[model samples]
Target chain A: MQGKTGSESWQEVWDKSVNGPRALIDCWQEIPCDPCQEACAQGSIVLSSGICAPPALHAETCNGCGKCVAICPGMAIFLVDRSIGSGLARVTVPYEMRDEIRLGGEAWAVDGEGNYLAEGRITRVSGAGRPGRTMLLTIEVPEEWALKVRGVRGRRKLLEEPEEVEAIEAVEDFAFCRCEEIDYSRLREIITQGEFRSLPALRRFSRAGLGYCQGRFCQSILRSQFLADCPEEDREVESFRVRAPVRPVKLSRLGGEDG
Target chain B: MAFNNFRILQHPVLGEKKNGKEVRIFLDGLPIHAVEGEPIAAALYAAGVRITRLSPHKKEPRGAFCMIGRCTECCMIVDGEPNVRTCRTMVRDGMRVETPRGWME
Candidate 1:
């Protein structure tokens, strides 16, 4: 229809489907994506203005068809139908892997922070469409985990279990202080203790702020933790410490040809 | 007989780039100028400086392996700093460097 937004098309989908429950398009990222809208047969999933706009689901009329869940390129959408009883929500999501994982298999659920939650059952598994690239799996999880549980696990599977795949995300490992071998935990502990109030004091007590990496990793963590623990303390530490000769060198480079 | 190919320069995704810098520095008081900004080990190889450091427990001659800094074979004392990661850290101008003999000073 003329001047119709995705909300309008999704409203039509709600009318067509039975018990159309509204599902929040949980993909919070600001990126261009709209496959879910096209995937819906009933026109329930809508991203009409632009791909960057968040997808909206007509909860009351959404038939739990699981089309939007499977077709989301960013995998940001989840079909949450909580009306299934005992706070148990049914979640339909996409699975990409060469391994033939079956339905009703026990899957571990975890949150965004890598915290382990309740394990759920794989209620349904189906590979649809040409080439069968995406496997749509229905999972029955507690209402709490419905928001968090993203993927499952498989043994030596080429397609890493969704949860595992997200976990291995390439966050740069903190260049731990090598001199005294102090890490994030040690820094946290030192900050929590009132004795060493600031980064300079913590460096004095433990060689945390010092070392070749020069507090690139622990500086921010230490500063925030220190501030969080002791708000009244006015220990202002420079956010970035610039160590002289930012790069390390070898002894041989200084001396010449006389071996 | 070669068993495992443990070479620092040979990486799958990254290749050794020619670091363009010519300057002199001393390693344990020996005259050498490694390519500035290249790994201390790579520059050492280019300048024919072997025996980066002696192992802590083994006391054996160790060179750079696993240039990604997982292996501590290339750890050495540089400008009075011990256990310096030569592989990961780049070379600088007029840097005073030394091969670490053991764990202690």
Candidate 2:
């Protein structure tokens, strides 16, 4: 829960539950989607404020069916069973990763940001009853960690930090027009020095967008960079002129020559 | 074969890519083996042909920046066609690909 929608929300879900176990839909984003509501047979999950609302879970109605877990496009739903034992609990999450976690096998429990938590045993790996591709991985962790542990290490090591590399000096050193090999530094220099008044003039002078791509990639970047420095009143950026034979056609084919 | 360092052996979500029919494409007249229907840019990258074209103005080496068809950075002459978006175009048997010298050329 290091990401948005902290463990407090999950704790709220647990506190509201009446039965043995319930589905905790941790879908934080208010994206317009409602497959989870339609998937639930018991009507436990409901998006009361239209599709662009986070799902409201009726914990009392949810029977840990794990239907929402399979149907959720984001795979944000999980079934948490705190009544499994005194200190241990079962946390069932949707796993789509290629690596497999065998039933009863030891797995390193990981939080939302993939930080290492307590080690847990893979209680179940159920893809049989699931509608689509995601496999339900039921890992039994400490009751305290049930709400915290979101994912498990499946044949892959967890919390391996990436090697640090030296940062580039200027932001302009990064290529802007990849086809023409134009960098931000060059563009900045062109704009600040007032060599070219407009984008068309700059395009002609530097040949930035005239390369193989024909201004498809660098046109937008050029406009943004130009507008950043220029006054808002005269910030009208023009798009590059698109010529015919837009699709690259073979010269031999155009000449009606057969191979 | 030597340039397979960038090739993804296995993806966590996508899994292994099941290659199609094996085909040989000529890159600057050098035979490079590739899977048919794969993007010509991917085939080229697999064979280590990164710099597809030189800039018309500065004559600087340019390779694939955006792997998608949107960026024409990976444009190369394919089957006698200049400025072909290799990242979008799929490879075929005996396909002839050439790196354009410069834009005006």
Candidate 3:
């Protein structure tokens, strides 16, 4: 299984930050959502390539603000501060469930995929009444596990130790960019050779987003897919260069009257 | 988790939503109830009519992915005009919508 897209930088920023708390967004897939970009008050998160692209978190600009946490419809944003103690980091996650949350109690920490990792010490809970209706829970966990732990579960569910298994590897041949006949497996194959770093190069190599829709349908998948495959640092968020005639038009319409 | 005829009645953030004015739209000569002011694609979805068009290359069913007008997957023959973006066009009373068998058609 491949690591999530655009997580390399999240890990980089997360591991080096001696500074106070900062927001770290776990959004990888390109769902048709972009509320997090509009929720940031510090202008740290931006969906540079419109709503189709995942929100890019500028970790340095973020002031550990929780504004983007509750605003996310996907519940993928998190705020972590390793500066709390010598070995403890405080991670705040957005909870939309109505389940009872006991403050100062221990809750089972889970990864992004809901697999129990370790028990997290609940420090505080707030946002009882907020505009977005999302409650934020501050859990203190080992500093090393802060970046991987995304959420905490209540004590109602028995602590069933998850069996060891490999993360599911997507093997379906479904193609999002049907116009170009590019599929996920094909994109992963291209990303592994270490050549697809730029947007135009990826497009030229794969021809996935250059179809009639011009990435209106496949840009999100392509962007997140690239980030997920190549977790290299310093990779700038990329989008396809604008090709005019945004909508499709017949060649006859572009040509001068039949001469 | 709540859905009525595939229409979201209330959302956590969007709150309660009441359909604007109900309008009549014909899809392939069949009467379909639709919400006025909403996109034609939305109305089609509410009516449980997906597969707006068959892709030109593979003849695969292509429906609305991005609700916005950017993606033309939901393009259909609307009011005698071909290749109309149903997601961008607002539903109008007595509108005729046709889902072409193939994009080339």
Q: Model 3 chain A: which ten-residue window has the lowest total lDDT?
A: A1-10
Highest TM-score model number: 2
lDDT of each model, Cα atoms only? Answer: 0.61, 0.76, 0.76
Which candidate, 1 or 3, has the higher TM-score? 3
Candidate with more favorable, higher lDDT: 1 or 2: 2
Candidate 2 colliding pairs: none
Candidate numbers, best DockQ first, in rank order: 2, 3, 1
lDDT of model 2 at residue A258?
75
Please provide, for model 1 over A190-225, each residue's C-alpha lDDT reduced to its tens digit, 9 standing for 90 to 100: 667647645777776767656444665356666776
Q: Candidate 2 lDDT, tens digit per residue, A1-259?
A: 0111324356655764324667877776778999988998988777767898777777666788898897788888888887766688888888876565789989878888887777889988887333346788888888877777778786475355788999988654766676666777887787777755578888887777876667876788787887786756266666677777776566787899973
Q: Tell me, by DockQ, which candidate is best.
A: 2
**Model with the higher DockQ, candidate 1 or 2:** 2
The TM-score of candidate 1 is 0.38
What does the i-RMS of model 1 come to? 10.6
What C-alpha root-mean-square deviation, in Å, does candidate 2 show against the real structure?
4.7
**lDDT per residue (tens digit) for residues A1-259 in model 3:** 1122358557745864558777777777778887776777777777766688776777767787787887787778888888877898888899865456679888877887778777877887887544357889988888888888888788556557879998889766867576656776777788787576676688888788877677766777777778877777345767778766776666677885541
Off by over 4 Å in 2: A1-19, A128-132, A158-186, A195-197, A250-259, B2-19, B28-30, B47-49, B54-60, B68-70, B79-82, B99-105
Interface RMSD to the true structure, each candidate: 10.6, 4.8, 4.2
